[model samples]
Target: MEKTYLTTDELAKKIKYDCRTIRERLKDSVLIEGVHYFRPFGGRKILYIWEVIEQDMRVSGHGFGIPMANGEVCHG
Candidate 1:
């Protein structure tokens, strides 16, 4: 399957979030590295996998809890 890769700005536009929030808040929190996004060619630039992110977004619940490393929420 072909995955759609999107830049931070592009993802912000599609997800209706400010680019800064995605960078500082979601980048390593809700949006994980290597799963949701990755730096291509070991470069600093990050590309997000749309399919993976979209799927997770659909199932992520709303609550106050810690976000697990594997993208699952740990309600404590």
Candidate 2:
């Protein structure tokens, strides 16, 4: 399967967040490293997986459902 890689800016646009916010706030805090993003060829360039991020966003709730090690799943 061909992988879709998105830069911070592209990801920010897709998620409707600012690039700076994605880097400073979401990068290591919520988005995580290997799971949500990756450094290609050990370089500083980071690529985010859109499908994973979208899936996470759909599932993440303010207060709800099953509590996983990473986050909560929405019940309704």
lDDT of each: 0.81, 0.74
How do the residues 1-76 of candidate 2 rate in per-residue lDDT, one tens digit apiece?
Answer: 5568899989878767788867765677678889989999999999998777777777865422333345433356
Candidate 1 residues lying further than 4 Å off, grouped into runs, are 61-76
Write one digit per residue (lDDT tens) for candidate 1, span 1-76. 8999999999989988789867866788788898999999999999999999888877755432454457555765
Task: Look at candidate 1 and tell me the lDDT of residue 11.
Answer: 96
TM-score, cand. 1 vs. native: 0.79
Which candidate leads in lDDT?
1
lDDT of 2 at 59: 82
Candidate 1 lDDT score at position 43: 98
